[model samples]
Target: MKKHLLLLSAAAAALLAEEATLAPVSVVATGVEESVVEQPEAIAIKEKPEIELDQVVFQKDLFNSLPGVRIEQTGSVFGHMTAIRMPINTGPYYLFMQDGIPVQSSGFFNHNGLAYTTFGTAESVEVLKGAGTALYGSDAVAAVIDVHSTPAPSEKRTFLFKGTGGMYGYGSGLLEASGPAGEEGGYFANVHYLHSDGWRDHTQADRLEANGRYDLAIGDANALKIILNASKTEAQQADSFNDYANITDRSKAASDDPNYFKALEYVDVKRKFDYARLSLEWSNFSFENLDIVTTPYLRYNRNRYIATWQPNLPANDNELTTLGLLQRNTYQADWGRVIFGFDTEYTRSSLTYDQKFDIQTSGWSAAYYQAGTIYDYDVDYFAIAPYAHLEWNMSDKVVFSAGLRYDYNKFDYTNNLEDDSYYYALTSKGQKAIYYRPGDRTDSFNHVSPKASLSFMPDATTNLYIRYANGFRIPQASRLYSMKAGYETVTLDPETSDTYEIGLKKFFARHTFVDLAAYYMNIDDTITRYKNDNGDYYYANGGSSIHEGVEVGAGYAFNPSWRFKIAYAYGYHRYDNDPKYGDNEMAQAPNHTGNIRLFWTPWQFPGFELMAEYIYVGSWWFDDDHEAGKYKGYQLGNLKASYRYDDHLKLFAKIDNVTDNEYAVMARYAYGKTDYTPGDPALAYLGVEYRW
Candidate 1:
């Protein structure tokens, strides 16, 4: 098995050397544009293709084909997660950006945040693995996903439209155009619409988005780019199932609730998001040897969600508005290049919940009461971060890099309903109302992260690196403010991680590329959620944990007509110290995962292209204790076919889970019950496009 894997990696590394070098310029690693091969760290680039990216209308599967990455999707609908280098799903472990701007406010937790972002207008994507906090600040512990918008085409004018319809009433339409705005300016714009009657009961989706960008050049040293985007999404949530053994009906809801959401089969999410950004960049505009870049941005989001709790559930209205700035300067020197960055953000958020029914006590016994206002709060969050990095090109065979970042964060919270009081039941002393008035408070934290790396090149095609990086995540607002019953606001410490890694990148024969990475991480003060015997929830630090993993990926071109790629990852993630769950495997930490893909273009068939892929995920644990039965491992196969037909027209079709396999993409335990969300069954889509 080991020998076979070696041969596969060698061949896989050989497939896409030229394409990897296509864009040549990227800005993800150090916030500066440079050739990809010049970076000392591990980074992968994914370009949009002429055909559909996946069987579904959404681009959730965009990175699943890559190695060391896993995106656990839910029931072929919305709910999704990004796991790279980290084992956990929902937390401050990952960061998502568009044109280097954050898609959402940091420390905010939303499972399906990707559903609202625009991807149709993107030119390419870059994924960076391991610790990025040395430059990214908070929430860059595991990985970072950056989406770069397409640059305006050189043509005088260009227009394109794409449409698709397929199984389950799936439909999609997109219109895009790019060209010169005038003599010295360029613009790109697009609008997209997608809807689907999901595969299961009470699950459907509708979303619309519009995005535009303008680029202007001012003389020899200054450039400006403006971006605007808006999106509206109405989607139903298909929650996971609790009974893992009895899934007789796959299309039904896992739990039966008598609330308005369940009775009328209403939606779980109704949201509107708008964003605007202006970037001013200067090359040789600072001192004789320095370049400076600055970006100022704004974001707004208004959303309402139906509470999924049992009994008389109410709705929550939330509004978040933010203003931010990112400024960076790089100095060119004979010895090495040095970069300095300063970032700041101001956010105002308000949340109001109405008529939430809770178990309260009128006297000595337990009672159920409908509370008028469970929570009404507003907060102002602020962050000021600064970082510096140095890239030293010692010689043709050796490169050294180091960086350090400091983040200062503060939150000022105020309760709008300070006078509003409520009584709670299930208290340890019988019946006691939790402190309904949290009053006003100010909290702050400071964290510093540092990193260093050394790279050696045996030849131009092979690069090896050893590095150490540190990252940390500040506590989420919800964890700090959402006090229930007897639990009060508990002062929390940030979660910190120290990682040591060694990796290799090789591009041989100019047609093959391969990469392998292994890492060990030690994390302290990992926060976990729990419920006491009285049913109130609290967050506490789970002493320590250990995560270690190995990843391999390769690509090779068999000939002018064929190409192949493969990726695999294996990891052991477990708790190092915790009272009851000591040494238990963490939930949702899949240990073994892999993907294999083959692409073919027949010599006789002029415009025909075909692709086949197989995916596998090995089970880790369902709960902290690890479930009892069933094989946690499963495999799936997907296929894609396309015909270019002509320069102005094309057609494509894709099928996922070709064998109709049954598996679980996400599983966990909640309220003492094990729950799992089954993977998507076989699904297909067909589409056509026209460009001029």
Candidate 2:
């Protein structure tokens, strides 16, 4: 292979680290300039590392060397899930943001959606690939993740604390504070705590999180801000959702009956989340051409579960509440730059599912006591979107853009049942069971999304582009009150997509850098969940799909400390015109995935640093008819280090799965065998931090 590509180009020659110099500026494709944007979609960023490590832990290390990201967890503590070139750990095609709004509360609280995000209270994390409905509308189809926090430091006044302990009895703590909350204002605060006893066996976990912020400087153009956050959790993952093929010790655990709950806090997993936000700003407002931003927000969530196969059923409650309004303005003429926005949201959801009575062993779910509440519901949702964006600059090597967004969604469902029966004894030994009544519904949908792009820099480190976008997704609320009231869940429709992209970026001679993107998507009406002819389970529109992908990334710097990075992604999904998964290849889709990283800092190292990583995942198909003993590839290896002394200490360490590779971070194929979820073996941790 050309001498392995010249020994991988002499091992990615020239690795830099002055915080990996150059290439670090994003405003998420244009929310109106915070500088450095060349946009054409497909952006991924994760900054904050230049020897600042306390050894953060998984959420997949916040995608180190980002590019076609990946995040999956189950070794313990917060089981996150994500995959970017589509499918593995999927859910409404991704879209979870925090500083750019949309943080859960999108069309019926997706299961495991963003798993109570906060990824350690962010401070940079932005990702966007193809199709984003010209500035977010609907579920943003293929990608969007924004989480930014940590800003409220201004020169003086500061304090931080950190703590850590390792080896299956792990512990963590963090506390922070930042200066002035007045007098030209500033403010920040954080609190975090976590506990684990995991590596397997009835895993144990605990968490508490907190956040507070305030900033003000209302003159000289105005400003004001406020934020608050809270979190709580208690976890235990008994061999994950049960059924692990006769269990040969894949971390033991297979539902310990816990004497069938009824107390002890419902005997297992519980979680809660809360958030509040407010902002007001001007900074120009009509005078210097215009600049305005406004925000009003509120969020809340709650979860409970205790019956991973109905072990006597009786705990399954979920709730959500949301409120929002976001407004924007940025207008700077010269026949170009313009942006206008309006987004409003309101959501309320509550669900309950609990039932258990009689029967003796039929197999998984139904064989014991009583626990009422068969099915209950409450849903209320409303959404609004209005947007516009533009960028011209047609010379100097062209640059053109356009965007438009319009979305309206409505739903109001109330089912507090007056009669319900949806029980199925071990899958059809009771001749199936499906019955329901308890109406009152209203649904709505509207969409209009568009976008265009063109860019060709030709100079200043290269650039090239082509793009088109449109996205949509709506129909959830658990696929609409679990259907049964005018089939097709009230005229199913909303699950749309249209994307086309091409990209290139370069920076070569300054210690290397490169990125590439390619995409094609067409999706429509795709909202699956089959089985009809009286086999129960419904929710239609199921058809059409075609997705293509290619993503690449590279980085090199062998200067102020060696560095190297690599990324790859490849996908080719099918199933166009589905009536039952035609052409297959779209369930857990993963044609290829990649990663590589190496960084060091020796050469009179002044603060020490090192990192090593390798990850790859390929081969997938867990259904949608591409079945054949189902596969689900895997690979991983990790190591990290950091040291700092004098400057208020900092020390870190990590070693994970370093060759302990046992695989199976996830897998499937039910009823006739095949199940896995064992991942996590060689582990280690160390930490310290202090600042002033």
Q: What ranges in model 1 sit over 4 Å off?
A: 1-25, 50-56, 245-249, 252-287, 309-314, 355-371, 419-437, 509-511, 627-631
Candidate 1 per-residue lDDT, tens place, 1-692, comes to 01111111213223333444532345798886665555666676665562254534555566777687887765425556777876647677877787787776775545455554565445677778777836687777777778775554343577889888877778889898877766566777888888888776656777777778776665555666677767676766555665655343454553432333342443343333334444433333535677777888887766665554323345677778888888888888888888998999998988887654443333223345445676788889999999999888889789899999999989898888764355353444555674355777888889999999998977766778898899888887767776654555466899898888899888664336787889888789888766677544467887787888988888899897888878888888888877656887777788888999888889999888899999988876666666543337678999988888899898888998899876777766655446577777788989998989
Tens-digit lDDT string for candidate 2 (557-615): 87868878788888878778698877677766778888887888787867888888888
The C-alpha lDDT values of all candidates are 0.70, 0.67
**Candidate 2: what lDDT?**
0.67
lDDT of 1: 0.70
TM-score of each: 0.90, 0.33
Which model scores highest in lDDT? 1
**What would the C-alpha RMSD of candidate 1 be, to one decimal place?**
6.6
- Each model's Cα RMSD: 6.6, 23.4
